[model samples]
Target: MYGAVLADGMGLGKTFQTIASLYSLLTKGINGQPTCRKPLILCPTSLVQNWGKELKLWLGERVVPVVVDDTRADHVKKSFQEFRAFGHGGKPKVLVMSYPCFRMHKAEVYRMGLDVVMCDEAHFLKNGEAQITQAVAGLASAKRRLLMSGTPIQNDLSEFHAVFDLACPGLLGDLKAFNKTYEGPIQRGRDADATEKQVTLGLERMEQLMKLCNKFMLRRTSTVLKALLPAKVEQVMVLEALLKGIKASEPTDKVVLVSNYTEALDVLGGMCASHGWPALRLDGSCSVKQRQALVDTFNSPEHPSFVLLLSSKAGGVGLNIIGANRLVLFDPDWNPANDLQAMARVWREGQRKRVWIYRLLIAGSIEEKVLQRQLAKQGLSKALVDDVGQQVRTFSRDELRSLFRVDPTTPCDTHQAIKCSCSGSLQDLDSCKERAAAAAAAAAEGAGSGAEQQGVLGWAHLARALDSPDPTWQAVSDFVRNNFVTYIFSDHVIGETQHCL
Candidate 1:
């Protein structure tokens, strides 16, 4: 059994890549080994239909996959009945199913074994104690397992351990051993008040973890898609900054609103109705069959829909809504990957218009704290996947305490912390102009390495908006369309990450 990971950033085509991998194996047998004809694809319920669509679109008459949407025991058992008794012959078949559906029929799957067992958005198995994770841990020890996730580690290193351990069981040892060895030392180094020695040790262990994991993981940033797509501008604005319909100003502009909670979606839907904006929606209440219809209607120019109301959990993955060049993530997700997935819905390869993605946060609220946490997680991901700078965030005892207390002192705690001096009186605003020029020069000269390089990857674009949401906001919004945004991915700064597909 072998385990590997395809940790490409969102919209970089992990789905199509997986499909290609499957196509290659079925069409060309690996030298001495027999080709894999029976493979299982486990994904979220919402993606069950899309997976089959992708496979069929690519493979066409060469192969047909059985997608198990009906999860009743008899139906699931019947899907695998051939596996129980027949030999591998005739048409090469594939099985695509949701995670919950696989849980119910794991016994049948386990007994039948498999050639390839791949999990999409494998981070769903991040929780070690979750029943789904536990079930997947067993029964695939002999098969080749491939885990695909844009975010392998979300909150902490333990989540990485769980998913990695599943894909390549025992590669990182058991949870307790992994925590003591890698998790503890790495986290301790990120503390704000940590001694120099602690920082050095954290860097060492992080590199070691990276070295071992890189053997099987193939990770790529969204930069790969830069050649195929048009420009994308992503901004992180306090809700107060949404003074006007800035990004989606045109009556013909297509927009999408994604919320972490469905109730919030309801409020947005009602707001659309109040404005008499035509909209289509996909959520838990919507059936699987209706998902494509909703997407088609939203994507079609003739439909005349103004926006698509999407609940992140349901429509986030395996969805392409390029018809809408503008998207607003109404709220932040504790796990940055969720927000990243939702944001990638539009700024992908097929988009014709320049893209704009907005991440709205209430200043000084716990919501802003969530954005800060996202930066830290991005650091961990960057460290593990690429030889990139360390971005994992560590909070001081006082900083952690502030989570409960709202700071009325600052309009933007993030800008204040970095000591950017971008916001204040009109005089400070002028200084911000000078500092912005210097920062742009520094970035052109390659900026500082590691952590320092992150703050400057793309700064000239954000200078004005840090002060006010006047035309200043418009400047930054327009600037983002052509630049790679690191301000949002910085461990110290606050903003949206690169969300290109």
Candidate 2:
């Protein structure tokens, strides 16, 4: 079975790419059976209709799109029967259903013997233990699997493993083996006390892992597609400066203000509404029906709404509102992908005007730190896909201190790009500590002596000991002596031994 992930940046047409892949497969028979090919696409409930619409628009008359409606139990049962006997009586070649509906009919799905399966916004399956994950994994008959997500690694490398494992199972090895081989070293390299050499080694391991997984994953950023994308002018404006500018703008100006928090949306919406620029707001609470109507109204110039206030998550993916060329990111999110997806709404394919993306930040505030973190994550993503030679740096003390040094009086320099460093969620810090404690326990158990009786020590113990009134280096040597394990993969794979540092 051939499986892969199309992790292109938001608005880069992953939907079209998957469509093209399916078309190619339909023409070029899969495993020498062209007539028996049945492909299944699973997506969020909010996107089921959109998927059907897009499939119809792109592959009209070329392939049949079998859409499952989850509203009626009888209709769902009838659809399941139809899907089980798909291709009979000249039926469609593709079956599209919302993830929720698929869950309800998982048993039927498992029996459908789908030839190919694709999951849009595959990050929903990042949790390996989730019922949906297990259900999707149960499609053992699928010959090919495709996962599409913009933010596959939202929090940690384990999340990356979870997504990649689905695309190419065992390509990253088992989760435990992956953690011991890659996660542990890469994390230790990010430790505050890590030496430059250790960091370099960790990065090299990460690069190797990325290189291995590169075969199954295709990721392209907007920068790479700059020739196709409309020119995007990104500006950084102070929050107060943004307010002043908004106040000066004409009521007819089309704008979309994006924020991570509802409070900011309320404030911006109120300000815009007060200025006679009627505003429409969409957030998590907005229904799928409401979102489509709002997007349509906002996109049409004839509509009364001039300013659309959007919460980042609700507007992130699967919804394309390309009417407004001017957008302001009123606040930043910890994940860079969210911001990227939000900004892509205006800079997409149908956009005729040059897009203006403004990021509003309070000078020297936590917002700046958040932006820095975002830049770092973006750089890391680039290194993994576009440029492996790029250096990925951990947060340094000087960098931390510089976050506070931006002059509040000076207009924030939007033109200057932040030097890219590599980082992810601080949750890894806790995971790293846990790994070290496990290593310590392993050491103590192996020693079988007074090490346990005298009081077992781990990296945390050593970290505390180093800062104590009387620092000790003895534990460091002891730790090294205890947990070290070296082994060659096999006699055939000679001269190289794998061990954790």
- Best candidate (score: lDDT): 1
Would you estimate the TM-scores of all the predictions? 0.84, 0.73
Write one digit per residue (lDDT tens) for candidate 1, span 1-501.
388888988788888888888777766757744467678899988888888888888887676677887777787777676444454446677888899998887876777667778899899999989988987776653367788988787778899988888888888988899988888988888778877898888888888887888888898766667677765555665322232344334556688888978899888888778777777888999977688768977999888887788999889876889999878889989887888889888977678876767777666778777776666666566666654344434445567566656875545565554445343344543443454455445435543123222432223224334433223245345444223222231111222232211
Candidate 2 lDDT over residue span 189-246, tens digit each: 6555788887887778888987888788888655445566555655443333344444
Q: Which ten residues in a row have the lowest lDDT in candidate 1?
A: 484-493
lDDT score of residue 270 within candidate 1: 85
The true-versus-predicted C-alpha distance at residue 290 of model 1, in Å, is 1.9
Error of 2 at 226 (Å): 1.8
| Each candidate: RMSD | 5.6, 17.3
**Span of 10 residues, lowest total lDDT, candidate 2:** 485-494
Model 2: CA > 4 A from native: 30-36, 69-72, 85-89, 190-193, 238-253, 392-394, 397-501
Model 1's alpha-carbon lDDT is: 0.70
Q: What is the C-alpha lDDT of each candidate?
A: 0.70, 0.65
